[model samples]
Target: MVFEAILYIAVLLISAKLLGELLYRINQPRIIGNVLAGIIVGPALFFLVQPIDAIELFISIGVFFLFFLIGLEEIDLPGLVRVMRGRIFAGSLAGFFIPFFAASFFGLSLDMNFIQAFAIGSVIGASSLGVAAKVLTDLGKLRSTIGLEIFTVTAIIEFIAIILTSVLIQINTSDAPNVSEFLWLFAKMGIFFAVAGLLAVFALPKVFRIIHSHLRAQQVYFGLVIGVILLVAYFAEISGIHGAIGALLLGIAVSRMNREEYLEISKNVNAVGYGIFIPMFFAGIGLHFTTKFVEIDLWIIAGFIGIIVGVKFIGSYIAVKIAKMRPATTVAYGVMSKGAVDLALMLSLLQVNMLDDSLFSLLVLGTLITMIISSVELQRKLKKIVQVKVGSVEIGMLPIFFRRTVSDKRAQDAMSIDFQKTKPNVSVKNFLNSDIDPKEETMVIDDDGRLIGIVSKKELNNVHKKSRDVALISDIMEKKFHTVIPQDYIFSVIQKMNSHHFEMIPVIEPGFSGKIVGIVSSKTLLNLLAETKPPNPSTKS
Candidate 1:
């Protein structure tokens, strides 16, 4: 049994890697390849691999880590909470109910019971937080305004769907409508959050910081993090919420640590997640696909898909339009992406004799098709978004799509070639005595003119005069600094400067050889933005 499980995992991993790479080379979402690998290898086609308890367990673990990583890297929890009340909340309310009621109404038209119809509605109503997060992360826009809005809205929609589904399940199984069950579950969710808040505010920071300061073994730290994630996840399950939420909450809490600490931990976590667990999760969705499509009524499935897709798109479009968000179509397609949650719900209903095999197959097939379509459309839409100014102050907060415009100026156009330069071996005394601007950074370069470090006049002044003659420029220069390529957008340069608190950055030649060509200062970039003349997009400095 163990050997067979290992063999199946090996095959899936190898297949996923090959297809994932192929998709990446063509600039498509690699997750599409990951899912395809699953379909090709699983019972849907080859019948060589089937979902077993062992595989299911691994996939479950994968899911926990997948959401956890997303929460850690992609989301800014405090920021998300702050923006939840405005257009984001409004969009979520509309997005959740439009498809939900539409699906339920369709189910009722088919003469299904209220409970079953409502259950189906819950499945359709929910947006996949996983899908939205993955696509945004792939496009490097998860931190953008649109990305934040998507995360906030998708999370709210899914949270409400889970609660509604849980309540409906209780009511369906009982002889009477169980108000007490609903109250209990709601109370549990509230308590779970209250406890999680206390942990985030009071417990996790101290614990992780102590471990980071006192511990030496990387394995121990990784093990402890995984342990914390599982413990919280277990609590979440007992509290009548999905374990993924707990993992996400923990991830958000852990992300509050100092950036250096966060990055150190994130590096290891991402390696394990992207390397194994995340791909496994996507393939596991594929594994659920069974070649059961022939028995379902094609027209019925088509109608259902059309209704859900149309309603979802219109609903999201209206909400975003009212909110005055740009690229409303892209946001609509993003919310349209489906995931394996509905399939799981359908399978559960099928097992309980609430739904027939044909209906189950119909829903699953419809979901898979929507998943692929949304991913393709979202990627295509993202590539075509033009960068236009929002406002002077708010421009920096714009989505990455703002940088994709052909008219945007590149780093080479803004950079100055006349800035001060110094050799790494030059004495600090000699460097300071030379004709250097105190306000500007002196770039330290090697013999090959490659940027190695930077020495600021302010930094040298802080050192005692007695040590200035003894110290070399290399000793005082900051070795770790950011650089921009000649072709990078000026907005990108501003972002890096804002992030790192740098006044100036070196412009280096692209590729392996980082030859220092010029420099861009915050003052110069600001002056350019203040110019009256429209920038010539074709010009390079």
Candidate 2:
């Protein structure tokens, strides 16, 4: 079993890597590679590539790990709250409520019992954090304010979804309820929060200190963390809550532990999740699709999907607009990207046999369609919300055409390095570790190795298309970058950053540029202006 599982993962990984690299060239998220692969192997369309149970187990592990990373990478709590409290917050609510209520209503219309209708709504109401995050990542806007806002809202909504899922599952039972006693559910929540609190207040510092002090058996520490996840999950299951809730609690508990360590763990977890567990989860979903949509009345399934998505989109759009979010257009459109939550809820329902195969497939289909459309809309229109301005500005002024250039110096006097200042094949990993202050723009020289252009943080972030995979100095270094000659004067750069509001400006020689060599940054310029005494008039004028 283990061997088969290992082989299955190995194949998927290799395949994902190849396709991922290919898609990456076109600026697509790597997750797309994995998800598309899952769909291809899924029973819905392709029944030939049957993944075994062992493979399914791997996929489950992947899902847990993926969420673990999300918890690790979640937004600043305060920032998240602020964004959620505003228009984005309103949009999230509208998105959740509209779909939820409408789905419930539709289920009832389909002659499903009241309990079933409510369950259906709950499942449809959940949003897809994975899909949303991946879309932003692929667009290279995950770090932007708008992306941050989206990710934050989706996370909070998921938390609510978890609680609702609990309520849906546990409370739906007959008044007596058979599994664990009623109090167990409440107790588990209490225990989780208590443990999470204690871990934050005391355990976290102590554990990190021990790990740092010992510096040995780092792997053992990771092992312990995994154990913590499993244990919490086990106890939660025993106590009547789903294992995923335990996973969340456990993630929260470890949230503040060493960031680097957490990132490392996330990498491993993602491999497992993307390569195995989560894929099986999605594939398992695919396996159950036995032409249910075709068998059922087209109007019934289509109508249900249409109404739920429409309400969500409309409600979110209106809420955002009311709250003064200018960029987000059309509520239904904004809120339509609800994939992860819905999928998770549906999968959970399937696990318990609450939703049969055909219904499950329909939900999957609806989610995929909505997700793709949302991504397209956001990328095309809504993405510009956060980047309202590119350069600095004074309320009213001549916008500066910011440029970079080398100081006006003789060839011999030019600031030069002993080592060849040519582009280096430095590793991306090295960039993370090295003091290559991305904010400090530097010009790249040509073969004669003369100054070409400058590179800025903003420039680095803009390389979505794969002109170069190596981050090779030559490939990525902006040799054709803008600049200001040293003789250009202060007002020129100010106008540039002010009107254009550039982060850094390359200072160069007037018409003498070979390669950019100097920078006049906005911060530095502001400081210089503040510190420098105004030049005395030549004739004491």
Candidate 3:
């Protein structure tokens, strides 16, 4: 059995990798292939793999780690606040409640008990962050209005999943429920949040700073944090919640630390996650579909698949439209993709017999189908988004895109250089002394007789003693290069200057195969601006 499990995991990953490569070629997400890999290796065709308790637990561990990473990435307090707003909350409520009620009605009509119906609803209502993240990323719309709407609504629904799970536990555990006994689970949940919240506000920031500052070595820090994550997870299980909840809370607390430090660590964590646990988790879900379950009744299977697959389309479409997503359809499609987490939820239900094998395999199939559609639609819509300016101001907080343009006057006057007009074959190094005549300026040239970099008399004296000889014009000459089309503007140059705090910048000639045809300076820009503007009415006193 153990050997089968290992073989099971190995074959599943290899399949995922091959499909992922194929998807990458078509400009589709690797994750799309991964989910489909699960379905194919699973019940859809191959009976090669089987769902076992151990396989399910590994998948669950993957889910916790995935969410822990998500929580760390989601440090936007203001964004979370926006998601928690009333409209989103309302949409999430409708999504969970309506689908749940619908699933329960079908279950009851089909002659299953209330508990079974609830389990069906739980399976249907869950969304996959891994699938959703990939879909949004592939669409290149993760920050789009629709993406936000999907994320917000889906995030809220996760809370509902937890609540629903708790309710099932209560129903299953209690023989004759008393109010006091019921209160225990809810009380435990409240305690979990209260403690997690307190740690977030106080203890965690200092703890994270200590780890980030002192733990300079990467593996030691990585091991320690993973240990903490698992420890929290184990305790969360002991504390009457899913282990994932503990990992999530741990992430939330850690994410609240100093952003720079947190971002650096997040970069490392993401690398490890994408490289290892994430793909393993996604592929492992496929191993659970044993194919024998497909012999179950067709309608019973479709009903299970329909509730899970169908609700995502309807719920995501309606919620996103109401949430004011610009192109509601595209957003809805992106949100429809299912992921490793959804499969994990299904397997969790299966592991505990909250869902039967047939239903689990069917829902997994739905996730698989929708993921294909999600990839196509997401990629199409993402190509339409132009880099638009939000307001009248040309300046973005940080220059995400640079349309390089420098005006000729500001470009020429700054460096005041005319390479063709100047004396040729003169090496600028002969005049590196600041004590030389101010009127005499040094021009630099590379071995190809093309200008590479320039050094001013003032700049030459400051060159370090060790860098004295080999620091040719190529070495000390302003290594940074900027370009100008004969018709560019001053404001653009200023923007670059603002970025690099450059007093002077080299300018390459338009359509010329030469090193910097000229240069530009801040003073030249100000002078040009002064020349263009109308003269001051009141002159000197």
Candidate 4:
């Protein structure tokens, strides 16, 4: 058994990586590859592996880590609170209810009982926040207004789905519905959240501070984080909620405190989750695929797929349109990209025997199809609509116009020539007294005219007031900063500038000379935007 487990893991990892790379090359989400890896290795194909107890345990841990990492990366509590408004709430309701009831009614037509149908409907109703986030992040729209609205809607949907799922689980376990059981489930859930919230607000901060101060080893610190995640998960399960919810809550809690430290530690967490565990969890789903669904009607399967895809798209479109949100098409597409929560719910139902293997496989197939279609479609559509321009170069249709702009317009085209340059040896007082624009950042150069560092006006102002003695420009200038070459694409440069929050970036000439050419600032970008018109709908490619 031990040897077999090793072989299973080896095959799973290799297949996952190979398929993931293949999908990535084809411009699809690598998650599709991970799921395909499971189907290839499991009973649907070779039957080379089985979902044994040990393997299942590893898969469960993988799922916990997957949700934990998602919460860490995606959920911005303060931001979400700030963005919550009537349109988002209305849009979320429309997105959630439309598919949910449509799927439920379709399940009933297929002769499923109330509990079974509702369970399946809940799975279909749940959207994949992770998938939508990935799509938005790849397209550089994660921070945009439409992106934030999508995120807000999905976060609310996931929370609602969790509550519905707990109800479903309770219904599945009981022989008949009882008032006490329903009340107890809700009570337990409420109590768990209240306690978790208190710990998050009051205790977790001090605990995390102590851990960071006392622990020197990265491994030990990471372990502590995982321990907290698992402990919360355990409490959540005992309190009759899903463990994934607990993990997500813990992630949000950690996110709210000490952002700088969390950012550093998140690298290690992402490495562990994506590098090993998350892929395994996805692959594990594919492993359960079976070819023994001959008794299940083909029409039922087709109808399920159609309903899942149709309702989500139309519902989101109508909702956003009625709410009068701008860029309605893009918002709809963003909402249509569902995440892994639906799959998680389906698996839960399967585990409890609320859903049969045949039905589970059908739902999984629907999910895989929608995920692939939505991701590809969203990527293609976003390229056509998202317009970014600098100077005379149009970057509205990226990758398509990428090469044209690269050859026609360089970083030098967008760079501001009217900027101050100074030697590192100059005193802060002397530099401030010189006739230079105080609003712009001062570039520090070596004796050879090569760009070395930069000092913002704010830093200079603080130094001027605090320092009893004179300080060199080198003493205050930031040494580590991003620099673009003159030959680089204007679009790529803009992306870097936006991501790093750099108001202005230094553009250096390529080759051994490495001389500072000029700088590109937000003012330059805004000028480009003013000159460029929106893409014409008739001319959209």
Candidate 5:
């Protein structure tokens, strides 16, 4: 059994990675490949693999980590609340209600019971936080105002969906559904939120601080995070909510910590998640595909997909339009990108026998198709406004430019040949006394002449003032600063600089041993932009 399990996992990982890479090469979402790999390996093809118990457990863990990471990446509760006002509520309501009711009506017309119809409607109503987040990140809009609004709306919708799912599950299992039972379920949800909120606001920060202070090993920290995540998930389940909700809450709590600490923890978590668990989760979704179910009505399935896609888009568009929000098109795309939670809800309904194999298969197929279409459409629309290319590497979507200039060229072309460089061992006092500008950034090099770190004048001044003993440049330098290579497009560098609020960026040679070549400043880029003229789009290099 152990060896078979290992072999199965090996096949899953290899196929998923290969297909994911292929999809990415073709500019399609890699998730499509992951899902396709599962379908091919499972019932859709040879049926070589079964959804074993052990594999299901791994998939559940993968989903937990997936939602956890998304929460950490996007949610800042205080900030979200501050920014989410009337427009967010308006858009969320429209996005949730239109498709939900429309799908419910369709389900009833198909002769499903009220409970089953409501379940189907709820599945269609919920947005996939993970899918929308991936699209926003790909377009480099994850931190923008519109991105936040979308995230805020999705988060709210997800919370409501979880509550609704829980209630539906209760109704399905009971022989007689009573008002008291409904009230009690809602009460448990309220208690869950209250307790989770209190713990997040008070206990979590102290626990993290202690963990950081006492544990230096990355593995140890990773284990602690996983432990907490699981514990929270347990609490959520006991509180009559889904485990994924617990994971998301814990993630949001952790995101509110100190930036550096959060980044360190999030980076390690991401490595673990994307490296193994998350891929398995998506593949597991594919494994659920089976044609052994009851006859699938192609027309009904078509109606399902059309309603989900069309209603979501129109609902979001009309809502945002009424709210007087700009960029209605972007918001519409975001609302249209649905997958993760919808799949989860459908699975839940299937487990309870609320949905038969045919309906379950229809929901899964329709959801996947909608996700792919929405992602492709969003990418196609964004490409027209801004396109960023660095050599053969594309850096998401950037703002459109009307003209081309020297500054619009590669970073290697416009970088200053002369820039300040110093050995890592040089004393801070001596470096401050040198000819380097106190207001600018200075690069630190090692004995072998490789770029090691960077130091700003403010950092040096702080070290000089705070420390009684002398310190080397290495002591005050920032070892984690962003670095650009000569081959990198200037637009890519500008995006980084603008995002980080950096006045200057160091340019290094490409390869493992990144040797400092030159530095580019905003001023230099501006001068180049002023000196150069626009080129014909068709004739320009």
Candidate 6:
């Protein structure tokens, strides 16, 4: 059995990696590739893999780490809280409920029972954070205001979905719903969250302090971090919530603490999480998927897919339009991308026999379709400028005259690699002592040459003379700054510089290495626009 499990893993990983790369080349989310990998190897195709106990365990671990990493890296708890009350909250509600009810009613129309209908609703209602994050990152909007709105809405929607799922699980597993049992379930859930909150507020910080002060070994720290996450996950399951929720909670908690330490630990977590577990979890989706769409009525399948896609798009469109966010269609497509949390829920239901083979296949198929459509549509809309509203400022449409000139160009064409840079460990005093002019900016880089932040001679001169000797570049550097990659369109770079009033933007290497490859100045981009400026009517050709 152990050898069989090993063989199954090897086959799945190899297939996932190969197919994932193939899909990536075509600009589709790797998740589609991962799922395809599973289908190819599982009973749907070659039958090289099966849902075994060991594989299931690994998938569960994958789900845990996936959410954990998301909370650790993608979410900003404070930011989420702040946005939860405004138009953002209203938009999130609309995005979540419209698909939920529409999917539920669609299931009821098929004569599915209440529980089954609710299951369908729950599955379709949830948005995939993983999918949306990937799409936003690809568009280079992950750090933008619109990106924040999408993530906040996605997080809220998923949280609601999880709550509904827990209720569904209890109802499905229990012997007829008793009031006392229902109350007990809610009580357990409330108690679990309260305890988790207490730990976050009072206990975890102290524990982290001790870990940092006494444990210098990265290996030891990594081990303890894993142990804590696993413990929380177990507690969550026992408390009738969900293991992934616990992992997410712990991740968010640790993220709220010291950032430098969090970054170090998050780096290691990503290595282990993505390296082994996350892919298996996604592949597990394919293990359950069967090419049995022909079994279901064609009309029913059509309605299922249509309602999931159409309702989500329309719902998000309405919400964003009402909220005054422009390019509502783009945000709509973003929320339409589904995977991760929803798939995790479907897998859980399937394991417990609450979700059947046909329904699981239908839901999974619909989800994969949405992911593909979402990626393509969002990319297209973002690539074309029909005006975008960021915060209070509205960026008008790209002029027809410059569309051909600027849209086709990339940041690397105009960036200067000769820009000044400084090591993060250098003292501000020493850096200021160099020949750099007071007004000149310097990019700060780490030992690996990854861009960390930006600093200026002027800012360093303002530092108290006594402390300037002790303060490092990392201490004084401005951490919040925009960046672009070499492949980023020049128009987008210009738009960002205009919107944020930035004089220069750092160009990082591709693949998120954050290594400074070059810098694009506002002056250079202005020149590009000037050269393309049409001759005035008064001037002779």
lDDT of 1 by residue, 1-541 (tens): 9999998998887887788889767755566677778889997889667788777777777767876776687556676577578877777778888888888998998888899998888877876665666677888877775676666666667656655775566456556656787677668778887899789757888888898778898789888887888788788876667677678777778788888878977888888877987787667666766567666567667767776666767766766665555456777777666664454445445545666656665666676667777777877776665333322222121233333332477887778988888888888888889877766644545656777887677787888899989898888788888889989987677767666544688888889787988888765674455342433579996
lDDT, candidate 6, 364-466, per-residue tens: 8888888888888877776764443322333323365367557667898878877777888888788878776544554545557888887666677789999
Ordered by lDDT, highest first, the candidates read 6, 4, 5, 1, 3, 2
Judged by lDDT against the true structure, how good is candidate 3?
A: 0.62
Give the number of the best model, judged by TM-score: 6
Q: Is candidate 1 or candidate 2 better by TM-score?
A: 1
Q: Identify the runs in model 2 with alpha carbons over 4 angstroms from their true place.
A: 1-36, 49-52, 75-88, 172-184, 215-217, 330-335, 382-386, 390-541
Q: Which residue pairs come into collision in candidate 5?
A: none
Ordered by TM-score, highest first, the candidates read: 6, 4, 5, 1, 3, 2
Point out where model 3 deviates above 4 Å.
Answer: 1-9, 27-29, 35-57, 74-78, 82-85, 166-178, 384-541
Best by lDDT: 6
lDDT of 5 by residue, 444-529 (tens): 45557788877766677777444524788888777776778887877677666665434677788888777778887776665444
| Candidate 2 lDDT tens digits, 172-284 | 55466545755665676788668665864477657756765686876676676666666656766666666676666556556666776567666666665555556455544
Q: In model 3, which range of ten residues has the least summed lDDT? A: 390-399
Off by over 4 Å in 1: 74-77, 111-115, 129-152, 158-177, 339-361, 393-541
Model 5: residues with Cα > 4 Å off, grouped in runs? 79-85, 144-149, 292-294, 386-541
Per residue, candidate 4 scores C-alpha lDDT tens digits across 1-541 of: 8999988888887888889889878877788898899899888898877888766887788878877776777666676666467676767777778888998898888788888888877778777777777777887877765666677777776766756876788667877778888788778778887899789767987887888789898688779877888898888877778788788777777777676877865887788888988788878888887766656777876788887788878876876765555456666777777657777777778878888788888788888888887887777777675455432232233343444454456677777877878898888888778888756654545557788887777788788454614788888888887788877876677777766534778888777776887888766754544344444559855
Worst 10 residues of 4 by lDDT: 389-398
Which wins on TM-score, candidate 5 or candidate 6? 6
10 residues in a row with least lDDT, candidate 2: 393-402
Pick the winner on lDDT between candidates 3 and 6.
Answer: 6
- For residues 1-541, write the lDDT of model 3, one tens digit per residue: 8888888777776777888889878866676676667667775567566556665666666777876876676434456576675676666666666667777788888887777678767656655455566666765657754566667766666646655764675455556767786688778878987887687659767776677678778688777767777788888878877777677777777787777867866777777676656766776666555566679788877776676667667876776656544355666665555665556566666766766666666767776776666667666665653322211111111121122222233445445464221222333344353244554334334435445554554465577656655454444555444445334565565655555533555566666566555655554554444334222459653
Alpha-carbon deviation at 5 in model 1, angstroms: 1.8
